[model samples]
Structures are given as structure tokens and as C-alpha cells.
Target chain A: MARLPPSSGPASPAPAPVACSPHGRFGPYGGRYVPETLVEPLEELTAAWLAARSDLAFQAELSDLLANYAGRPTPLYFARRWTQQAGGARVYLKREDLLHTGAHKINNCLGQALLARRMGKQRLIAETGAGQHGVATATVAALLGLECVVYMGREDMARQALNVARMRLLGAEVRGVAAGSQTLKDAINEAMRDWVTDCQRSHYLLGSALGPHPYPAMVREFHACIGREARAQILQAEGRLPAEVIACVGGGSNAIGIFSGFLADAGVRLTGVEAGGRGPQLGEHAARFAGGSPGVLQGTFSYILQDAAGQIAATHSVSAGLDYAAIGPEHAALRDEGRAEYVACGDADALAACRFLATTEGIIPALESAHAVAEARRRAPRHGADAAIIVNISGRGDKDMEILSRELGLGGAADSPVD
Target chain B: MPSDSRAHSSSPAATPAAAGFAPFFARARAAGRPALIPYITAGDPTLEASRAIALALAEAGADIIELGIPFSDPVADGPVIQRASERALRQGVTLEHVLALAAEIRRRSPVGLLLFGYVNPFLRLGWGRFAQAAAAAGVQGVLATDLIPEEAAEYRQALAQRGLEPVFLAAPTSPDARLAAIAAASRGFLYAVSRTGVTGAREQVPPGARDLVARIRRHTTLPIALGFGLSTATQVEEVGRFADGAVVGTALVAAVHAAVQRDGPGAAAPAAAKFLRSLRG
Candidate 1:
């Protein structure tokens, strides 16, 4: 507790206004701005959540689920070689990749699934783009013996067919949405459609830290356990918290999860790395950081890359997961408050770091995570050798290897190339 | 039951819907026909055109106007509504503009306005602010196409506090108990989704929709409005026979789109009015 930084920023000429409000209002950003019909259920969730917060049983149960089912308390391993190359800044990796289902997604899914079960819901529904969240939801539905249906964009279903098959094999129904662009955006559209039509027995498990109201708050709470564990582990391992903590942002769940632990702390500098793609030019990147305005997309008010008329413009990124047009509401708030700094990493930078880590640290990160690793690698030289930096290794690179090999000219590397 | 007498309900202020409903609903109820609730995408082709379409719908015998605030992904909507949403979004219709249009309509039309939209926009605006603004804009009711009844507390509180009704959908897939739960909490009117899919004209309402409506009736005394696929007069009459109101959206929007394409903006609204009045007749 003493190690945590103070809530307000240290005295500065113009301290960035503390972004988040108690009721999830990040200066006019986050709010419970949903349809009137969903108000009661959101209230129930809030009530249940409030009760769950202090209930010893709920905490213990959540801990047990995290430890046994989700396989949490993920490691923070020292990246010796990567650090040596980084102008001597000691780098450590919080390995969320090694968690069950091979990404940090499962942590939130497990918690949400349990909450759904406790709520007496009989079924779970979700929308998936790259099919990562669909796979994660399917895994939980299988484990809990709950009915699950996932809506995936028809295009994404075709591109990420393997993930679709994996979800189906797990006994969850996968519906390929044939609407709009047939991508993640469309999948979310269809899922919301399903939720409106089938809200009685179903719970819509959102995949990211985006969405309106309870979702941003709820997903953050679930993922907060990640930060909680990491905080305790880091404190136990090192004399104090690291100087800077970094994570890749795609809907920003993993980054927020790690950052929430240090939100009140003024000393820790939180950095969220977005997929810069080809650069900041329109249609070239998905970095809402590099180019975004406060607008509504998905469900919440956040930084969205929209056209002049507030239309969702087409976004591009090497990673399907990070090719979104908006950032999470919390991240948008954090950016506004100056509590965090957002950086954009291009495809070249991420790929370079992916290769660098594979060669130097013997670890392969998801293309999304590689964005943070790339930034850390680039900035490590400036931080000095004694400075400690923490980068969240968000996922195992297995899902990305195929795409990376094809895109990056890695002809035949069963083992990804070293830097 | 007379039109003149209907203007003043015996105890309107005491009742929820009766309290807020005006002289328009009075005449509508006395006519012995269910209210025609026609939905149209605001700005399917253009904002001005959509505004004209709204007026045309009201003139065409629509008692309550369910103006659809188009979303990028309209989940509960079928192909036609999905297409309509796409067209509206392409034309740059936003939630802010949608509410502004409703405010504009309130300035001229006495027709009861109920906004039909996805939850994302309201969520984006923050429920409290959206509800207050919507109520101030003369929106009597809101039908969120995506919000579940169980998660409706904040939205419901905000809407109720603003004197706006938060309407919920009762579908064929819902169980008797779940229908009861939704009906008990719903206000203004229960949006009885005729089928499982999103909003669009269907060949027919599912055989179970009538039973679902009946089940909802048993739970609450609120009026029931049937929607999702009742485009033609035949379906409207069919739904009117049992429900208090019938909502026609996709078909009306389609007509407006067709009229706009054929005769341009000048004739679109009148054409829509003519087409919509045909549904009630």
C-alpha cells in the first residue's frame, strides 16, 4: 500500500486533470449510457459487484478460479539478453502469454464467466474478431458446462478459420456474421443484435476493455487481478515497484489490467503502445493515439479514429487484434489526464522486436505485444542501464507466427528468427 | 371512446402512459384502431430527407413515431434493417443528430415519439445525459434494440427520472418467466419482437409471438406494441388485433428510400406518408 503512488499527479505547471470519475466518468468519457431496458441488469451487476468486492467468499472463490482454472499469478521474468542490448536498462517481462488459452484474455473471461454463473445465467454470447476472445469464451463455456454462442465476422471467420474451428470444437456455436464489412466491427454489431434479441438467458461477454459502462469497469475489474498479482510479486521480488510499466494496447485490456495496480501511484509511468501500422496518416494506422479524437465508437466515449463526419473510418494494422478504430475509455481518460503516455509502434518496429526477443530472450510474443516490446527496445537506450522497465508479454506468438512468416518474408522458420 | 372525450383521460396523471400521452393518442385510441408505429432511419439518404420522412410517417396515420437512430451494427435487425442502418450511417446520421431531429419533430408534431436505437449511442453519451436530453426533446419512450432487461437499472432510472419510458423487447425465444420479468419492468409499451432476428420486415410473425404477448400481458398492465417485420397492412391488422400498437420500421424506411431514388427529396416525405397511411387503412 505504501509503495503505491498517490492518486493526484505531482505538482506541475498544469497537472493533467485526473481523468476518471468515481462513477466511471472519465471527464465526460465513461458513463452508463446504454438503453433503458438494460438499466436493471446493469444495476444487478453493479449490486452483485459491490457485494462481491467485500465478500470474503467471493474474493476467495475468485482467487481459486484465477489460480486453478485461469492459471494466474503469471511470472515476471528478467529478460537478461534483451536488457543487455537495451543500453543496459534491466527489462522484465510479465508473462501473461503463458496463461491458459495463451493470452491475458482468459483472466477476464474466467472472472466474467463466474460472475455470469453467479447471476444464474444459463448461456454466454460474445463477438470475436481474430477469434481470440471467442476461443477464450468457448474454453470457459466448455469448462463451466454453459451454452455459448460466438458471432464472428464472416471475413474474420474465413481469415482466422483455425480459431473458429477451435471454438466450435469446444462445443460453442460460432455464427459467421454476414453483415457490413464482416469484420470485428460487424461481429460486435451482430453480438449486440443478439444481446438485444436474446438477453433473457444470455450474457454478452465483451472481449476487450472497450464498450459502454459496466463493460469498461467490469473487464477492468477482472483484469485488475492481473495487476494486483504483479504488484505483490514485484514488491516481493524487488525492493520497490519498477520505474516504468508498459503493455501493448488493443482495446487495451492487458495494459489497463497491469496499470490499474499503479494508477494511484505517481512514481510509476504507465505507457500503452498502440499498433502504429504504416504511420499516422489516415488509412495507414490503427493508432488512435497518433490520430484520434473524442468520439463514440463500439459503446463508450473514447478516442476514436473517425472521419470528418464522425463515421468509423477503415483502420489498418499488421495485427488483426489491434486494427480497431478506438481505444478503451479508461485509456482515453488516462491519456487526457497525462497519467499515461501513448506511443505508436509501426509494423517494422513490432516485427523487429518480435525477432529481437526470439533471438535474444528465447520468447515469442504476439504481434500485439510485440508493439510494446518494440517501443521498450527503442526507448531502453534512453532510460539508462540501472533503470528497470516492465513489458507485459501479452500472448504466445504461436497465433501470429503464420501471419508474420507470410508478411515478414520469414520463408521457413519453425523457430522464429532472432533479431 | 369518443375522440373528444378521449382527449382527457379519466385519471391520466395517475397513470404512467396516460399521464404523458397527449390529444393525439386520445384521437388514436377512439378510432378503434391500434396506433401505427412506423420506424424510419433518420437520415437514411440525408438528414433533411429523414426528417421529412418522419413527418410523412406521422401524417400517414402513425400514432407513435419510432425513429431509428442508426448504428453501424444493428444486431437485432435483419437484412433490410441492417441495410437501412448502413445507409443511414453512410449518410452520417449520429445519435446527437437523431435526438436533435426528435426535438425538431416535437416542435411541430403532436405525435408521441419513441426512439428506437442500439445501446452503443446512449452508452457513448452516458445514460443520464442521454435520457434527460431525450426527454427534453419530447421523446416519450426509448426502445434500445440491444439492452437486456436485467441490465436496465441505470438506464431505466435515468429514463424514469426524466419522465421517459424505457421500453424492453419480448421475443419468441423468451420463456414465460423471462417475459414476465421484462413486462413487469417495461414502461410506455412492451416492444414485442415478432421473431428472433433484428428489425426488418418478415414474411410473418412467428406462431409463438401471440403466445409471448399473452404471457407478457399476464405479468404487467402496460400496453404491448408489436414490431420486427410487420411491414404490410395485413400484418399490421394482424398485430393490431391483439397488441395495443404495431411498429413498422424497415418497410417504411425502404419506401422512403425508394421514393427518394425515384422522385428525389421533394417527393420523398409525401410519398412515405402516402405509403405509411396505406398500412393503417
Candidate 2:
């Protein structure tokens, strides 16, 4: 526990760093490492971050964007049918997927767009996987009148065609990243390199809670407002917090957001579910928590799945969102603190959960989110009928249905095989 | 991060070598004088001179020595420190050699020694095991230039679990609250980066350093050690009036570089060691 300064009277000590920037290390990782061209923007970001956390105007504008633009206070729906189907445990979902841009990705993008505008930056650049964050960035960029460029792996652009179309329609210049492994990580590398080149006109709207200092901290702060509001709303609606809080850990922004609200509350069990591609034994899992050690990459140290020589190891997951070799640094610290437990769910399990939730709760979850669903399903039986689990329904699965169907041997078409 | 260049033993505090820290601090308290920390890159040339310089710094009245863990790029450093880093890198000094030299120093000196480097070396060595080894090697503390305290909590925890101090840098640019935050998480002295630029001696110290020192004092009772500037005894004396300690880096490295140039590899050690000892006066 951090030693809190004795408050003058009962006043709460200026809100202690929580999540991302908490302790100023993204969990215990994240720092600035881009080229000199980006230094001023980063310095501005650090300054803005210090100011925005306390500035009422910044908070109010962000709040307004969340309400009017992003459709936040997204429903906390009670999954009654799914609850009974999943071993009699009650389940509730904080439906972030229902928000604008079809996922919680907008929460961070909107805030970053606003920050970019405030900094007088006219161009917004980002890297995407499954194009969820790209679509979100493009959506916000259009809304904010900022020129947007999104770097996505060629493979991802091909697979997530609809999202690519959505981004183009939203006025973003989508670039197919051709370097490295040609995946999300590769896109990030390219985007960072671009930011290094044109940081003056562009702001790299990071999609998740990872990367160097201000980013991990900044992204987490924007996302944590989700948990803060959800926690209060859940308490008001359900009379108390849930026994267990679960979120899929792709870059870990959403999970960290929800989990930060409960860090000081020792009783709330936080579970972060990573992608368990085939299984742990297959050596292809995106479960950094399960199979990583402390290593430096992209300028910070955290639990990175790296080879003996410090090269980033390849990561795999059925969910493009979960296919990251390293998680956000704060998640790494949380894992170390024993405050949160990290688990993994495989391709079949996540897809099955998506199908199960669609049929039982009428909610088709993103593949990344279905991993949490799978985890909750596994734990619900052990905890019994009274257990309450809250899952951050981080995104909608509309984009993933094609891949899911093809992989599940249901054919790539929307029509059922029987039909 | 400088941490990548210095190969610290995983548990620096548990090491019998660090048994010297408590006594050193005790002695400082008795002497009513702040510690002087002089930083130098190891092996500006070959092995022999590096050894001589280490002994000279100890003999020159430096209460603690901060060893530079040289890497190819020292981003947080300015031209002087960068040149020094380049010199060391040119000589092909790996972190392992620095650690072995630190072990040699443990055998020779009673002064407190801290390894300063970027995070790469520690990450390469693996943090947990390195902590244990650093402690055993008699190294007292670690200040990783690039290991932001927020991202270093696990390593800090691991180091703490093993009783080593993960000394953190508190820069003039850091927010007041963050200064306190870093101070709170830090063990040993708080390294105050004198300005926004990298490690080097400046002709004029930043004007607000006294206020920064006062501000840090409010948040942490830990000794405030000023670095990134002080090169001479006069500069040290000036900073010593407001701060508890002084760190000199570029001047030491520049001296080593000059010595290497003048006397070749053979003369570098004595020349570098002699320059460091002069600062103690």
C-alpha cells in the first residue's frame, strides 16, 4: 500500500495516481522514447496530462464528448438468460460495445482527439488491429475535423475489410503496414516511426493503454472514467459492486480501467483474460501474463514475451485485439501486486462464448470480450448461483463474425448451413 | 536508460557489499557533511586504468561513487556525457566488465557505490537475479536513467523484496506531486536532475534549484543529491549549501577521455584517477 499523506482535516489527498499513470509508471512500465522530432509534443502531452487531471474545463469538455458524441453511460445490462445458462451465476455487462464506433476504443480515441485539438495538432495518426481502434480514431477525427491516418497490417486490412471501408468513409487515409510481422505490433512500429517524422502536425492517438509514459497513463485515464461511472452506477443499481470484475486484456486498457476503480477495494476480485490462441501448450498464445518475463521493448520494461536475445516473440490469438506480445505496463504491475489475476481463453472457447451470449443474452460480443465471457463461465460454477460477475463488453462482434464463422466451419456467409 | 549499461546484481541490498551503506550513512551523520558522488565510465581504455581510477575516486574523499553503465545512445545525456558514453562504447565496455570492476572496488573501498545505467542491461541480465547479485557484490543502490519509477515498480518491488534500493530520479521538470510520488517510492537519496537536459556539468546551475530542493524537502526527508551539473569543488560547495549531496559526471568522463587521448591506454587510468581526486579538494 502506498503511504498516503495525512490530509488537512477529512479532505481526500489529491486523487492518488490510479491505473496507467498511477505511480507514473504504466503499472510499472511506459516512458518516452520516440525521436527528437516528437519531443515537444510529448513534453506538451506530459504538461497537458498534469493540467487536464485537475482542470475543470478539460474534464467538462471530455464529459460532454462522452455523453453527446460517444454515447457513454452505456447500459449496464443484466444478462439474465446467460446467467442461468452459465451455472446459475448472475452476470452483468458494462456495454461499451454499444458506444459509438462499435467498441470501447472510442472512449480513448475521443479523448486523444480532443487533446490533439487542444495542442493545435491537425493530423491524427494511429495503428490498428481488427481496425477497431482505427475506425474509432477516424470517427473522432471526422467529428473533430482533424485529418486522420491509420496504419494497419495488410493482413488485418484484408480480413477486416468492413472496418477499412468505414475508416475511408469517415475520411481517414488508411495505410496498409507492410513491415515487420505485418500485424498490430508492426502497425504500431510504423505509426511510431511516422510520429517521429511528422510529430509537428500529427498526434499519435494511441488505441490502448500501452506504449511509453504519458501514453499508457493518458490512455488509461480516459478509459478509467468508464469504470468510475460504471462502479457508481452498478452500486446504485445492484446495491453493491460485483464479486468479480472481468475484461479481456488486449493491450489491457479496458480491463485496467475497470480494475483501477476497485484497486483500493481489496475484496473486489479483478480477472484479466488474455487470448489463449489454441492453448498454453501450443506456444502460440497471446497470454503474456502466462508466459512472459521482464524485458525491454519500445523503451520500457514490462512482462514481454521475448526470446533469449531480447527480440519480441511472436504472439497469436483468435482475437486480433489480444494478439500482442506485451501487455500495458500497469497490468504487469497489477499482476505483480497480486491485485489482479491474469487468465487465458482460446479461439474455440471465445467464439463459443460469443455464440452462447448471442443466443442467451442477445448480445454478440467482440472476440476479445468473449474471452472474459469464457472466463466468467468457468468461474461462475465454482462460485455458485449468488456470485455476480461484471464484464466490460468492450466491443461489438459485427466485424469478427466473418472470421468466427470461417474458423468454426460454419462457412463464411451470414446464412446458416441449414438455411 | 543508464540501467541497461550497468550490470547490477539482482539483490543489491542483501549483498554483503551493501553492508557498507548503513555504516557509510552513519559516518556521514557523524561527520555532519553530505556525501559526494562522482560518476565515471569504466574502461575509457582497457582494464588497468579503470581499476586505478576506481581506487583514486575512493581515496579522493568521495563518500559514494556513481559508475556510468555505457550504452551506444545516452539519450538523457547532453554532448559531454554523450561523448563520454561514446568513448566507453568505442572501447567496447560491456556491463559485465563494469560489474566485475565493481566487485573489484568492493574488495578495495569502504565508500558507498551505486550503479547507474539505462534499463537494457538489467533487462538483459533479468531483474530478479541481477538484484541478488548486485546486493552480494557490495553495490548499495541503483539509479536507472530511463526506468521511469511508475514502470519500475515491479523491479523496485523485486529489489525491495531482496532489500536493494531502486533510487529514482526527480527532475526539475517533474510536477510537484510527482516529485513527492517519486520521493515516496524511492530509497536512499533522491537524485535531482538539475535541468531538462541530459547528464553534464553546466556553467550556471538552473536558478530554481534551491526552490526545487526546498520543494523536494517538503515531500521527502531523504537526502537530495543534485546532479547533471556540478563539476568542480566550488560548484559542489555551492550546491552542498542547499542540497545534501553533489554528483559530477561529464567532467569525470571528459578527464578520462582526455587521459586516454594523452597517455594512451596505459596513462589513462592514473590521469583519470588523479583528476577525480582533485574534485575532492
Candidate 3:
């Protein structure tokens, strides 16, 4: 397993020299599967990433940005009310929601933007679903004064109108992809096409840990500070590692980020909650690990939802962020090695969890993060009261007001005066 | 899309070097002209119409006919070919359908056959099964667009065992070391991508293309087919200055597309033949 972050607490002591994903593989997964036109650029990226990983100057720059710009060391808070109510394990919340741009996505965006600048790239390109990544990319582009373009599906743009406005206001071009399924999968296709056409001048700042080599490893490293901080904080609070760490897996950036800290800790359980849209049938849900088999999509060899003819199957999810047909290649490797467990959180349960967290703790979790909350709610009461479970609240639900209002039928009702 | 194409697929293939591209290149060399290969998406507009287009391309002196197996997502293709693939896929074309088309076309003409696709569908059918099946259908070479030499050991072994060749693409960005590796892994002909972009028709062949071909020539004696932008006779003649063959993909695809749109599928074959002859003259 790749080592997490440098920590003051008892962590993996001094990781090996190599930091990238073994140059292009994670066991049987994560190969550089692309046209020869992209091979040279991927190689160049891999080399640059390798050089930057150990460069003290580069690390110092990223650390400074994370702290001063994106707001690093996102609090690992004890959820006293939720913990008392759960009546089982003490619950902790990794407050990535408090980060700038309102999500953990800023962690990755800042790092990749810096890398793009370092590489002398003239443009930054990305793909997004819930718009968190897009907003974060746009925010970083504004901060760095770089040209930015984000590919978002038409369906996603509809639900994420708030973020669409934010991106445009932040001076990034938002291209609405109208292709297959009109969601994250299609958005990714359009972004990759854009990158292929202008790879020399642009950097494909992939938002997840699911693309071709280096990216899966690179994005994870960028977000690894989440796990690193949580590990150190949890140790100070609970005096030991938590019994479980839960996060939602879309293309699996945040989950992989937080999981990186505890990957080597055999005592800590890693559970990835995927979006179970409505049912277990294909096209009804986006739970790849629950229903998918090994296949390649968007350049990674991972568990993917595909038809018998190898065409990618359509996926559904109430939370746009978790509505992808495949998981990250490393996540697949971790699943195969029994290092991490994956489960599905249906739309209803996740929605309920979102409201429950809001009412119980005054924290409105993003629908994507609510999947983890739903899983934690289920597993909390079952575990011992002394045991601790850290749930990664990946983002705030402020952007989800539109979808939430529509999904919960909270709209078209007469306004009530504040009591 | 069921057929009797696989009826003759059970018998394994003979040596691929003797069967398809080698003889075609030899013939073109004898004619003192660069080889012309025309590519079309099988089942575009309709599968039967694609058959006529392939036969027409063969009759128009195409050294090889490449049949693109439609996939749900084609990242390395430009808008024209992407739309063609979308049309083919809407008609429910799969690798098996393309193989069936190749088998039918094989029976009617001795022209070289190559199946172009991405890695997922090819691996979905399993390399062993796909190789046997493709070779059985008389396909000479297979070009999995995303399969690089580093990840193609199993694929090369599987295809070579079945007397089929693995065609690899060499890009302008490919360094000499990578070019040598790609050349060593390839069997029939090395695909020299003229530029660092998706397949499309361009106004003129970029000057970088000839340099790329020259670099690739340092690595292999195998015929290098210059691709990505030879849309006219001048362009094909321009390629003859450096490479042994010119691959026409998006340009011919556009011609067939317009023909089908203008006069229905019946006119696509004649239009394709006319387009190829125009490219040669």
C-alpha cells in the first residue's frame, strides 16, 4: 500500500522513496491505457510527478498553499450529539466541508494547479459531476491566474446550477457535455478528448483517482493530508486509531485520500460507501463494487459496470458525485487484497442521513458525504460504545439546496415566517 | 446479428506475414506507388451498406480495408468518426458483428482486412477467444488503439499464436526508444500517426509527419502507414515522399456519411469508390 501523509502520531515511519503508483500499475490495475498520442505526455507527467514528489521545494509550496489558501488541517471534530444519540461508537467528523470551495476537492485542485504551473502548462482542463471539483478547479485557476475549462454533463449542470455560476464567475469556461447518459461518465469523455487535442499546451487535471496511471496515485497524494490530519487528531482525541473510517467513493478521490492514512493500520477498518440509486439492478445504481466486475473505463482497469458487449452501463444516483460506473484502480486492488470493504447506501437512506445530520448536529452533509453518514449510522450502534468511527464529510450541502429542495418535495410550499 | 461467418472460423490461421499486409505492400512497391488503406466503421448507416463500401474500396485499389468495431466511447477519434461510431453502435454493432462483416468481406475479396478497436471490448471477448475468432474470420491484423507495447505482451502472444499480427501506432511524440519498442512489437505494418491528436481530416499533412516517419524508419523495415490526415491525392503523394502507405479514415468516413445522407445508404459505396480514386489521382 502507498503510504499516507507525514504525521506526528504513530504512522508509517518514513515511506519508501517511490511515491507514485509504481509508475503505471496497482497490482493488475492502473495501466496507462491510451492512444500512443497520449503515451509520451503521460510519461512526461509521470516523470514530473516523480521529480516533484521528493522535491522539498515543491512540497513546501503545496503545503503553504494548503494551509494559507485552501485551509489545511480541516478539523477532525467529535460529534458529541450524534455520538450520544447513536448509543454505540463515539463518532468523529472529518470536516473537509469547511475547506475553501466548500469541499475536500480544493485539496486536489490546489496541488494539481501548482503542478500545472510548475510544468509550464498554459491551460487546465477537468471533468466534474457534483460541481465541487469544477468549482475547486475554477477557484484554483483564479488564484493561479491560469486558463481553466471544466467539462460538466448537461444533467449535472442542471442539478449543480450554483456551482456552474460559481465557475463562470471565477473565470472558467464550463462546457456542458450532452453525450451518453449526460453525466459524469460523459463529461469525463469530453474532457479527455479536449486533453488529447491540446495535451502539449494543457494539463488534464483529473479530479479523481480513477484515470490512467499517475493520476490515481497523484490525486490521492494531493488529498492525503485529510487522512494525515485525521490520524494525528484522532490519536490525540481517542488515544488510538479509530475502529472504522468511512467515506463515499465516486471516482474515489476523497475516500482514497482519507483511506491512505489508515491503509497500513490493520486495526482500522476502511469502508467505502457507494451510491445505491434505487435498486440493485444494473442502471438503477452506481455501486460498482457491489454489482460490477473487472473492466477498463476512462483509462483505468478497475471494477466497472459494463454490459455483456463491454459497453459501459448507465449509472444512477441521487448524489451526482457518486454516480460513476467504476471505482479507482487502487480501490479495486485494496478490495481484492481485503484491505478495504465497500458497501452501498441507497438514495432514501442517504437522503435521510443528510437531513438527520442537519437536524442532529447542524451540519448539512453533501448528498455524496451522506452516503458515508448512512453507513456510519448503520454501523455505529452495532459497534462497542468505546470504539470510534471517523466519517469523512466530504463537502457541504449548500450547493445541493436546489436538488435537495426538488428531491424532498420542499418546493412549491407557502413560505413560513421565522419563529 | 447472427451469421454463418464463424462456420469457417474453427480452423486456425496460417502465418500472418505471408497472408495480408506483406503481399499488399510488395504489390504496391512493384507498382512504384504508396499503398492506400481506407478505413470505415462497420455497420455505419447499416452493416449491409458497409459491406458494399468495403468492396468498393477494394475495387478502387485499396491495399487494405480497416473495419472499425464500434464502441460506446471512442476517445481517440474526432467528431466525424465519433458520429459514424455512434451510428454504427445505435444499430447494435459489436466486435462479433465486425468480425462477421470481415468474414463476409473476406470471402468476396482477397483484400487485406484489419479490425480496429479499443482494449476493453477486445479484452472483454478475452484475448484468446478474440484472436482465434478474428483470425478465423480472415482478419490479418488487429489494432487495439489504447494497447501500448508495454501492456501488449499477452495480446501480442495471443495474436501471434493464431498467425495474426499486432499493429501498433507510433505517434510524432514517440521518442526513438519508444519507436524502437513499438516497431519490435508490431507484426504487419507500423502505424505512424502524423500528429499528436485524434483521427481527423486536415487541410494538409503537417511537416512534422515526414520527420516522424523518418524517425520511425530508423527503427523498422516494416511498411509504415502514415495516418491521421491524408485526405487528398496531393496529401497521399506528399506521404509517398516519406512513408510506404497512407491511411484514409475520417475523410473517407465523411464521404460515406455525406453520401448516405444525400442519397441514402445505396449511394455510399459508389461515393466511397469515387473518393478513394480521387485521393489516388
Worst 10 residues of 3 chain A by lDDT: A1-10
Could you tell me how far off, in angstroms, the CA of residue B196 lies in candidate 2 after the best superposition?
A: 18
**Candidate 1 lDDT by residue in tens digits, B1-281:** 22633232132222233345444444555677777778877877777877777766765666778888887655456777778778878767788898899887766666678888766567667788898788778778888765666556878899889888777887666666777778877876788877665666778866877887788888887778887778788887787677778888777777877777898877778878888868866
lDDT per residue as tens, model 2, A88-196: 5578898889888899998888778888888889999999997999999999999989999999988788778889999999999999976445678878866776675
How many residue pairs clash in all the candidates, one count each? 28, 35, 0
User: Model 1, which residues run further than 4 Å from truth?
Assistant: A1-27, A54-61, A412-419, B1-21, B43-60, B63-69, B91-197, B201-229, B232-245, B254-278
* Tens-place lDDT digits, model 3, residues A1-419: 12223432223334345434465688788887888888888888878877777666777777778877877778888889999987899999999999999999998898888888888998999999999999999999999899999999999999999999999999999999887888999898889889888999999988999888889988888888898888988988889899999999999999999999998899999999999999999999999998898888878889999888888889999999999998999899899989999999999999899999999999999999999999999999988998999999999999999878887777885788667
Q: Give the number of the best model, judged by lDDT.
A: 3
Top DockQ prediction, candidate number: 3
True-vs-predicted CA distance for residue B5, candidate 3, Å: 29
Candidate with best TM-score? 3
Error of 2 at A404 (Å): 1.5
- Lowest summed lDDT across 10 adjacent residues in model 2 chain A is found at A1-10
- How accurately is candidate 1 docked according to DockQ? 0.20
